[model samples]
Target: MFGNICTLYYTRRKLIFDFLKPGNQCRQLVPEATVDVQRRQRKMTSPDDESRSFFAQTELDSLKGKKAKLARTGTHSHVFKATMDSRGNAQVAVKLVDLRSRGEYIERFMPRELAIIPRLDHVNIVAAYAIHRTPEYVAIVEEYASGGDLLNYIRTRPERYLQEQEAKPIFRQLMDAIIYLERLHIVHRDIKCENIFLDSNLRVKLGDFGFARELRPGVDSNTHCGSRPYAAIELLSGRTYRGNGVDIWSAGVVLYVILTSYFPFGSSKDEVPAIIKRQRSQSIHFSQRLSGEVRSLILGMLHPDPKKRLYSRRILAHPWLAETPHRT
Candidate 1:
């Protein structure tokens, strides 16, 4: 079993979800008000211009004092709403993660998380623009979504099951992002409804790398981490396993949740552990609303055995996903 040394961090984690969808990259990083153009302004000579480094921590501290919007609080971090001047683009939402309260053990994993965040540039994953480290707090600056998270997105919908038209594009983009991260040897240890974000244009962007890691080649992470309901059998059972399969399993759980607004496994906290216990013998009860193609993909992804779980190649080739057009 994974040790309890880092359990405090796990309890403190207040994971959130997202809403909205778009095909275009979700990275318009300007703030709502006119940002003082003088603070580390990078000349935007062309559309292909590289991003300029963000303002110094001193400037951020000053900006954070004014109109500070506290967006979220998880176990070890607080997300503040802030903005940076990005040339003349519309002022976009920026998220500042305050990582002062996390356990030392969790903090040790942060550098790895921060290292992976900025290296990612995907339409379905949140983009990190800068990092600020102060003795009081370490913060990462990232793209902010105007829309809510996945849980709220599903909850606010008119009905329980989102139409295939709605779920497909978002899931497809998420799959693309995951594939990209896997290629970079990175794994988002935590994949759940709350970690998925959405932009004003309704585009999906995956976020929250506090539990993410970059794996060494052929290495399986020993750290068992992720939300209970969405966790794979291996992580729930406290066994070492391949990160990609674990992620895909969690993603499959998310697919089930969004489709049904209910968990296919255990529904309550006390039942969560039992879900994994039964993962070996009990067959999943699929929603009648699910088509055979999507159901097959979900079953492949949620396979109890890590080695048999779906990978990007098989997932991309799945008939349903392959033929499903992103009409949204």
Candidate 2:
């Protein structure tokens, strides 16, 4: 029976792998044709001249007391760390997305995270201070979290995780962020530890809404967009499924890693057949050191069936949350 199940799992995985391969899939989903046209138009126009004139006229009135300095360069954007913004007189992080170079249609097609961020006002969510758009680039100014992202924090301070009492509050803060996203009908496709930022007080703030998609009242998303290990079985199956459930599954993986410092589904580099077989058969095992409630919560979130998984709101009200109070 076990061997038969393994064979079926391997077959399903191969089908998904074939579907994702370059030439086998339809090109329409890639939007390459649209990008090509936009790229041609961009080359004809004088991008530098347009940017200079636009920046000069804009006058940085909104950024009154702030002094922006280039922080780091991401794959698609340049990050800036600005000192003391006009609104809160607090440090802010700004991301400048170079649309002119990437292609004109790319900016338009790219997710309007600024529009979505302002609509979301939660203690556990990173606040969008201001948005500036020019012909060359689209800039988003947001509150800076001094404590940095969860992944970096974990790497620097592995001892913090050993203190379950301290970690409880942080977990609760993460739950708050997830609950808020669910209420907005937004599913954060990527919910890994790296995406969760921490303020000076160590309060959680969910960042990077690039992969997030809004779900209509009765509609569900089918896009397989997220980190591989965090992806749920339904997503790995290459079938259209509710994105919210996938986010819950990723959160479960994050929770497991935070507690045990290891992944539940092994690693992404593992053999495809072995990974699928293990995931399909629900062959996950937790360390004996994990508490009963924590194990139960992780299992609840990692339910194979989306319908059976715990919703964000319910998770916030769970007994584990009651034991750990999250303060803004």
Candidate 3:
């Protein structure tokens, strides 16, 4: 709802580039010193492709000649894995969004996401090297996670869930990315396990920013974006909500799923209304397998009241994250 108004007033590029620019409405949200430090850190930590430029141009012919396999599909985009160089060694992920689709996402959300990905340069975030746009499609070249997304990783596991020790560092890294985005005032409205990627070492790298946006102080987002199960009750109930709270709630759901390998509310998407009902009633249940501290932290983040919900900073400081996992 708010996005349509934004599109009418500001060009898509302006909306994306002006995120932390001086004179922008939310520029003061992040300090100049913090931005400077991030710039230096990006130079030191960003991969070679990311350091080149945000809008590095890739020849369409190069992509056309490569053998690509469909990696995943989203509501508005298809991600493919392909080799960027000869010998099929330099792997990369290419996200293709069909521009001609009449989908609401194509007109409202895609442009902002396309613009935001390149600007992000965090270790725990997937790096976008180049973007190729055309009337038919927009192709985004990104870092490839050899170990795949967390959803597939968990689903394929024999036990269907990570041991507490195994889940801790991965969740910590995911929170690191969330904390970084929080500092930048960018909220990843879609923070589910499917969007959390892992490398060969199983290190966390949060991907997929299709439902993301920059927030201004005192302004509330009216869009009901993101996966229903991972969405906050406020969004599901069609209430105007703060972006950070929405993210924290989604992250809580992610933590719950990874630790239990099951959704906290309902079994399927058709049960979202029931999920909302349960959420509002606070009729939540935890797996007996979860530790007391982790359960308390999850409850804190999943608080029905947005005002009382634990934010990224508070979640990071929770004793559960710092505790050593004991074998059962």
Each model's number of backbone clashes?
Answer: 16, 0, 0
**Whole-model lDDT for model 3 versus the true structure?**
0.70
Better of 2 and 3 by lDDT: 3
lDDT of each: 0.65, 0.64, 0.70
The top-ranked prediction according to lDDT is 3
TM-score of 2: 0.75
User: What tens-digit string does per-residue lDDT give for candidate 2 at 199-313?
Assistant: 8888889887766778756786667667777778777767677647888888888887777777788787876566666667767788787778778888888887788888877
Total residue pair clashes for candidate 1:
16
Best candidate, TM-score: 3
lDDT of 1 at 93: 36
**What local lDDT does model 1 show for residue 317?**
83
- Candidates 1 and 3 compared: the better one by TM-score is 3
